[model samples]
Target: MSVYARRRRRSGTLMELVLTFVALGLLALLTLSGIARQSAGEPILPWIQPSSGNHLPHGVNYQIDALDPTTLAPMATLPQKGMVELRLAVTNDSALPVTFSFPTSMQCEFVARKVHTYVGGLFVLPLEVWRSSYFHNVSRHASRLTLNPAQTKVYVANWTLDPFDTGEASAGTYQVSASFGKSTIPLHIDKPL
Candidate 1:
């Protein structure tokens, strides 16, 4: 080939290479900006669902014990206006320890009439009302427990129905929800007549 022709071909090839690189750089910039816009609020992982059943992000398993009143059996009955002592046990069922936060509000009232009745009639006595107060006062500081691999800890959640505050909650049903970050578990509560 002639020298002039060879030189022209080499220059054209270099220009084409530069243009290709510029196009690729622009594409990369656009891709990054699009990601930033989509994640403006919070980062979402396609494989991670914080609200999934007791499974932690790193494969940690957790157990929540059924609430048992200290003075009565799990299925036993008690006065509507008395204190109900309960404990929540968390067990780490994995090989590694996991750290998590607990929810403050778990108990919900269903029967407004029963709650009012109990509050007005039975919870009048300070001592009887104090029994239920113990759990609420102490539970505030009992959360934030850490567990090692195969470790377990108990958390106390007390529920009291005052005699004059409201009626005894109905005998139907209620729920106590436990939460950590975006994860939560709801436990059913049966009110005794």
Candidate 2:
């Protein structure tokens, strides 16, 4: 016999195979759970209404809508004062995925300016701005986002409105606008919204 003994070839242990299988199975279960939640129409959103208007861009479109603060439902009327929520939706309508580079985590900026209409619907002047939420994530870091074709991303922004703070936005008409990337959409902000 040779001085050196021939060692038996090692194979994966039973525990190793079982662990790997269990990990994969767990991952699948979690992924399916998320899919089921979305497909089952669970209350997974802050708003529960269809969009009103859409920006008909070629590649990507945007839609802005108001939502009731308490029930988190879609508000058809102008957003009311007090706690308000706006739904910002960005959709990828192109065949390929669309990517956006944001300077910060705050993907959008919102501002509502008091609309001063003189002599009925004749002269319109925008007064002091209210609910001006310019920055949410103040970080200087940049972030990149990619949306697959037919994918829509919705962001909910909350701001407390008090006519007391600025006499401009009190129980009246205002122009509420949101800016996403290079596009901006404005809607009338009235009462009982």
Candidate 3:
């Protein structure tokens, strides 16, 4: 082959090598971007299942119960301007005492007014309401609590109803639900009188 022809062929091969490297680098960059986007995407959280009388590994048992106002005062008619009491039972099913730190709000399928009160222990305190602009002025509060094994503590929740508030809704039957962790209990609030 002629010297000029051979040099021309070599130059062409070098150009092809450079282009190939550039293309490979761009592909690597795109793949890295895609992976970063996938990681930044929202994470799927596992659903929390209800406890089937099984104690948590920490030996803590969380439960919710409704205190029938009827037994005390006919369940407080809607717009009656009174308090509906709820009892939350925390028991240590393990062999040792366990301390529980309460969370601010529990996830649920619906919305309603809520308040928390710790009772029957050293952490006894007044009721605290979960306050929001969507609802009336109420303070939602919680306190750290501890329980001994086989010991059960009751936390009282007082849900206040304003006869005039009616939750800004027209007169109708409304289902009020309150939840603590995985435990939820609902109450029926009839429309205003």
Candidate 4:
């Protein structure tokens, strides 16, 4: 073969190899992107089987329960200054499947007592709402969760409480609650030690 023709063939082969590699690289990139979108932190989450509840006569029935995070035990009272977790378990009582949307952050507040005291001089503090900083800047995206008939789903939310404005971390009973829609779970908190 002529030198000119040989050089042309070699150039064409190199161009073909480059184009092939470019196409393969793009295909790999597309595949990796799809995998990344589907994998939402699988390393942190364990697989949980769906549990079914008994069919009820009413529609969706929701029960809110307070639990201690450290022990995973049910709680009736919490400490004055610590994290409180409220689990809202919703049972689909109707025959139809229901979809509910709730924010990732939970809304909660504290209610203090107002009484006539000789030492504290009529100590009465107004209600204090615990603010969550999770979705402060970005607009919160509500999660659309669905529950089939007779299926129960429990959602957990936590709130950390601080002392009163007057630094009155005194020994007194207070009420704290987490509310979702019209349903709420009210629990008492003992005085901070």
Candidate 5:
């Protein structure tokens, strides 16, 4: 073959290869942009709906049911063999679906603080008579639960303790509260004799 002809053929092949790469690069850019547009406002997990940041929907109803028996029964001995079921009923009142974003596997935490009379409401002893975090064994995962309109889901935790009281350790007025849904219920426990 002539040198000029051979040179022309090599140049043609080089130009074709360069043009092919440019076309592929443009195609790749278009494909990635389309995907980005589809996922603009969505989280990584599209199936799991995300709630408003750190705030539950205003219309959603999340409340603890009335405590059974309404009063703490005095314990006859220490470490009473009893249990209380803490039930949280979450209802979606809005027309749209509501999502609960739990950073941990625990949906909520129950806490009890002893209120001392010596200080006359000025001093509250930080004592937890019962805690679901220690007693409840649930699979740990950062998860989300979505509820449709008018749907209610109840989460229950079985706390092993006397109603409103655990034992000698729980004698006194307790300012009780749940970490989730935000509620406070005062409970009185008679001092053990």
Candidate 6:
């Protein structure tokens, strides 16, 4: 091939390669912005759910339910600014007394109410950070409760959003469940009025 012809061919190939990369880069930017515009925010996945009939292993049944402490009624959704208490009704099927140990702190999540409650983990991150990081569990102490066989006692863990918190504590479906030994349940929570 002639020298000039070979040089021209090589430059054309190089230009095509650069144009291809520029097109791909523009395409990527457009795709990412479209995704960002579609989502309200990131989906929260805080607590891992279980798949089985019973997770409690101690022959003790722990039914985790929620109560509106003010109304003293069973609740499906907790008020955003009010208190919703998690009640653990413990029944020992065994023939002996079992001591129940509640975790230091129970977790609550905002979720979507539907066929399945999708947990919103990040929604409550600010509250958690305020509780643990700022407060640091000050003045908290250890306590345990014992239950007799065939007896069912209800234990409570209450949660509420601070009225002054101006953050996005949106009203929607939420759940609060605690694990005792190897069992846990999800409590339903609703957004504030």
- After TM-score superposition, the amount by which residue 101's alpha carbon in candidate 4 deviates from its true location, in angstroms, is 5.3
lDDT of each: 0.46, 0.63, 0.48, 0.53, 0.55, 0.52
TM-score of each model, paired residue for residue: 0.42, 0.59, 0.37, 0.44, 0.51, 0.48
Tens-digit lDDT string for candidate 6 (52-99): 334554767767666788877887665656666667776888888877
Please give, for residues 92-152, the per-residue lDDT of candidate 5 as tens digits: 9999998777767776666654544322322223455666677567776787778899999
lDDT of 4 at 158: 74
Q: How much is 136 displaced in model 2, in angstroms?
A: 4.2
Per TM-score, the best of the predicted structures is: 2
CA RMSD of each candidate after superposition:
17.6, 21.6, 15.0, 20.1, 19.2, 8.9
lDDT, residue 41, model 3: 23
lDDT of 1 by residue, 1-193 (tens): 9999999999999999999999999888556544542322112322333233343446444444333366345534434665555554556777877777545442211111112212222211111122223333434433454678777665555566555757644454343444444544444445665
How many residue pairs of model 6 clash at the backbone?
6
Worst 10 residues of 6 by lDDT: 124-133
Please provide, for model 2 over 92-141, each residue's C-alpha lDDT reduced to its tens digit, 9 standing for 90 to 100: 98999878887776667777766654433333456646544554336678
lDDT per residue as tens, model 3, 67-168: 456564444334445555555566779998776555533222223432211222112111222321244433356445567789987656555556466554
Candidate 1 TM-score over all chains jointly = 0.42
Q: Model 4, 184: alpha-carbon shift in Å?
A: 4.4
Candidate 6 Cα errors over 4 Å, as ranges = 1-54, 99-146, 165-167
Clash totals, every prediction: 20, 1, 4, 0, 0, 6
Model 2 root-mean-square deviation: 21.6
